[model samples]
Target: MSTEAVAVSAVSDAQQHTPSAPAQEKTVEKVNLLGMSRPQMEKFFEDMGEKKFRAGQVMKWIHQYFVTDFSEMTNISGKLREKLEKICKIKAPEVVHKNFSKDGTRKWVFRVGDGEGSLVETVLIPAEDKTGSRKTLCISSQVGCALDCSFCSTGKQGFQRDLTQAEIIGQLWMANYSYMEDVPIADRERSVTNVVMMGMGEPLLNYDAVLNSMRIMLDDFAYGMSKRRVTLSTSGVVPKIDQLAEDIDVALAISLHATNNELRNELVPINKKYPLEQLIAACQRYIKKDGNESARKHVTIEYVMLDGVNDKPEHAQEMIKLLKDLPSKINLIPFNPFPHAPYGRSSRNRIISFQKTLSDAGFVCTIRQTRGDDIDAACGQLVGQVADRTRRAEQWKKKIAQSNEIMRSQG
Candidate 1:
C-alpha cells in the first residue's frame, strides 16, 4: 500500500516526530516497548527497582495468560502493576472489525502504527480437525506485503513497513485473549498450540524482529510453546533460511508453488533472484542438524495447486526427486483465490492424482483442505481497509471491495 494509503487507526504523523538530535548524532528512536523478551523485560524491571521474577510472572500472564492491561494481572501488586502500566504498554491493535467463516475461521481487522499512522488486516484460523492435537494461528509480519506474488491479495496491496516484534507477537496475544474470553479457562491455554508466520510479509526480509518474536513465543516462562510447534514460512529467501534453522530452530515451510525454474520465476518473483536449484540447496542445508531431538529440523514445501499449472502428475514426480532423502513433507495447498489472482483451484481429480504420485514415490504428501474462504480468512485472502483522506484511500477501498466480492461469490 502507498504511504498515503495508510488508515486513520494507525500511528499518526504526530507519532512519527523525532526530538532534536545531540550534536552531529541522530536522536535515538525510542525502543518499541512491546518487542522485548521476558528476560529482557525482567532486566528492564530490575533496572526500575522491581523484583526480578516479576518479569517471568508478567511474561507468562502477557503471553500464555493473554493479559493486555496491567490491571488484569490481579496477582501482581497493584503498585507494581501500576508502575508497569505507566512505563510499558501492552498493546493489541484495536479490532475495528471482525468476521467468522462458517468453517470456524476468524479474521480481525486491526490498526497498527508506522511513523505516518496505523493500518489494518489480519486473519486467525482455528483448526477444523475433530480430533487434531494442534490449534494454529496464522499471523502477519507486515501491515501489507512487499513481495507481490502473482496470486496473493496482500501482495497486490503493495509494500508497507515491516511490523515490529511487538506488533507481530501482539497478534498472538490478542487472538489468544479474544479466543479465551469465549472458552473455558481450563481449555483456553491448550486451544492455541501452533503459530505460522505465513500471512503478509516476506519474513526473512524482516529477519531480526521475526527472530525476536520467535524467541518470545519459544520462551518457557512466556508462551512455553515447543520449537516444533511454530513454523516460519518463507518464499525462498535462500541466505536467511540457514540462520533461521540455526538461531530459532523452529519448523520451516517454504512457499514452493511451482516445480521448475520457468513456472516458479512467474509464480514467485523471488525465484528469479534465487531460483529453484539454490532454494532447494538451502532447504537441504536446513534439514541437516547436529544436536538432540530439539535440534533435528525439517522443512515443509507448501505447494499451491493451480489448475493445469503445477498440479500435474509429472510435477509431483519432479517434486519427489527434488526433495529426495531430505527430511521434508509436501503440503498441497489448493489455491485460495481473490480478485485478479490470475488462477483457479486445481480439480479434485488432478489434486488426488498428484498426491498419489508423490505418495507412491515414498514421499510424505497430504492435500490440505481449504478453510476460512467464506469469510476471506483463508491462506491468502487477508486485506484490510485504510480510510485515507484523499483519492488514494478510495483506490485501496475499490481493491478491497473487489476482493471481498470474490470471497462472497466463492462462499
Candidate 2:
C-alpha cells in the first residue's frame, strides 16, 4: 500500500475508536454587526423598523471611523443611538494574548467566547518594498482545522466549529485598530494593506462566513481593499474553487505541498477526495477570462518544502511539469517546525536549488522568507487552544509523550 493509503487507514481506525465530545447548548440574542454584508446590514435595520440608510451610517461608524461604542456615533440622533445600543452589538474577539516577533511580526491569540472558549490566531507580516512598508494580515476562518495534514500544527489540535462572520472579519478590524492605536485619528487609513485567509483552518470549509467576511473587507465602508490585495488560500477543495470564482474575484492560492497524488494525499487528505487532475481543472476554470480580458489573474501555487520528503531536485522537475500550462507562480516555503512536528525544514542550499529549477523552467518562483517563527506565528505553525470535538488532541499529546520517552530511553 502507498504511504497515503497507510495514513488514511490509520485515520479511519482512530476515528472508529475515538469517542466524540458532547455538544453544548447556548442562547445568543444581540446581533453582531461586524461580519454582515451591506445588503444583510440594510435588511437588519429595515427589520428593526429603522430607515435602510441607517445600515450604511452604522457600517461607516463601525468600520471606517473605528468607532465601536454606539455612544461614540456622534452624527446619529441620541434616541437612535440608544435604540442601537439596546439591540445591537459591535462584537469583536477579545485579544487574550499578543506576541511581537523580532522582525516586527505580530501574532494575536483571540478568545472567541465563554465556557471553554475557543481560541484562534491571527498574524501580521510586515514587508518593505520600494514604495513603503506593507502589512498583510493572515486571518483564521475556523477555530481549528478538520483536515488533519500530517505536517500542520493546527490540524494536530483537532476539529472545532467554524467561526462566525464576526469572528472572521473581526480579526481584520482588531488588527487595524491595534496598528493605528498610536497614529492620529485624522491620519488613520488602515495599516493592513493586504489580507490572506491562510491562518488556522481550511477556509473553503467555512464558505459562507469567509465569503461574507471578504465582501465586508472589500466594501468601501469597511477596509476597502482591492480584489487583488485579498487572497483566499485553500487546500484544494475542488467544488469551492468553482463556487468562489462565481461568488468573488479575489486572488486564489492553492496549498499544494506535493507534486503528485501519491504524496499529496498523505500531505493534504482533501486530495483523496479531489485529486490533482480535478484540482488543476478547477484552477483552469477559476482563472478563465469569461468576458473581462484585462482582469486576468494568475493563481499562486504555495509549496512548503520539507527536508528529505518533498524537496529533492526530482520534485522540482515534477512541479515544473505539473504547472507548465497554468498561469501561476510558485511560492516555496521552508517548513516551520513546531512541537512534535514530524518533519524538518529543508536546508537553505536545497531550497535555493529548488527555486533555480523552477526559474530555469520559465516560471516565476520565489522562496518565502521565514518570519515570526520565534513566536510560533510563521506558516504551518498556528496551533490555537481548541476544545477538540474529535478527541484528536488527546491522541496527539499521547504521541508526543511516546516520542519523548523513546528519545530518553535512547539517551
Candidate 1 lDDT tens digits, 4-94: 1121111222132123235357323332345567656665555666677887887766677665678877779998766655445566666
- Candidate 2 per-residue lDDT, tens place, 330-403, comes to 99999987766778999999999999989999999999888887888864354434234556767877887999
> Could you tell me which 10 consecutive residues in candidate 2 have the lowest summed lDDT?
14-23
Tell me each candidate's TM-score. 0.82, 0.88
Q: Where in model 2 is the C-alpha error above 4 Å?
A: 1-28, 182-184, 289-296, 379-390, 397-411
Q: lDDT of each structure?
A: 0.72, 0.81
Model 1 residue-pair collision total: 6
Which residue pairs clash in candidate 2? none
Evaluated with lDDT, which candidate comes out highest? Answer: 2
Cα error, candidate 2, residue 246 (Å) = 0.6
* CA-only RMSD, every prediction: 7.8, 9.9
Q: What is the lDDT of candidate 1?
A: 0.72
